[model samples]
Target: MDYFSQSIKQAIRTVPDWPKPGVTFRDITTVLQNKTAFRKLIDAFVHRYHDQHIDAIAAVDARGFIIGSALAYELNASLVLIRKKGKLPFDTLVEDYELEYGTASVELHKDALKPGDKVVLVDDLIATGGTMLAASRLIRRIGAEIVEVAAMIDLPDLGGSDKLRAEGLTVYTVCSFEGE
Candidate 1:
């Protein structure tokens, strides 16, 4: 593994259960709190697509907002937020995605990205891939081209990358829980 990638894997904290019972939440807060690790992560993302023509970054809601905004600044690209329904203040394009137990929705401003804008979608982690898929649909609705789907970590056992790959979305992660 690369230096920064290895550091990120070390920074991930394995919480047995979070937000519910029996679900292990691989928290990234530890990495965020460590200045060196966090900078390495930011640099990792910047390094991957530094030469790509990115017009903006479509970052998922809540946790995604944390690094998404900073990433956009690092790349000097526009920031487009993919928020939960009723959260966006302007006219929006929303999508409902299915989860194992239920369904939830996400919304993006109608003007978040202009037609033909090259965008990179980012989020903190991918567990089931529902939220990111929903965000992708919303971005496509507004006519933005998704150059890549970037995540801080990928939980392959949960089928995150497989599901996204089925839809032809290329996924990149700084860390993986595939064998963990």
Candidate 2:
């Protein structure tokens, strides 16, 4: 990792066996709580996409909203929310993806993006590649082009990043945990 990535990675807190046995969660709340770290985190993203001509950020639900909102402001782009099914009130497009245990769906307002809009999909982390993939599909269904998929942390051992790449989507991450 580069120096900036190292700094951001250090700000993350890891919880062992979270929500299940043998599972580790890389939490970004610690980074969000630290003013300096949070600034650096946002700055890193701004520097990367400032010149990309991005029209909007299609962020996965919850945690992704935090990063995407700040990034959208910095990039002077719109923010589109991808939420859990039924969370959106407007007409929506839904995509279902498989989790380790079951299937879950994500939704985006049908009119969230215009055709040909350039978008970056943001998320807190990439573990299984399901959520981001579903969000990307949702964006495409609206005829928007996905510039890339961005995340703060990647658990490569789970093959999320690799799976995304195999689907022809560019994946960018500040840092990665190889073995979880």
RMSD of 1: 1.1
Candidate 1: the clashing residue pairs are: none
Best by TM-score: 2
Model 1: per-residue lDDT, tens digit, 93-162?
9899998889999999998899899999999998889999999988888888899999999999999778
Segments of candidate 2 deviating more than 4 angstroms: none
Model 1, residue 21: distance off in Å is 4.1
- What are the lDDT figures for the candidates, one per model? 0.90, 0.93
Q: Tens-digit lDDT track for model 2 on 69-140?
A: 999999999999999998999899999999978999999999999999999999999998999999998999
lDDT of 1 at 73: 94
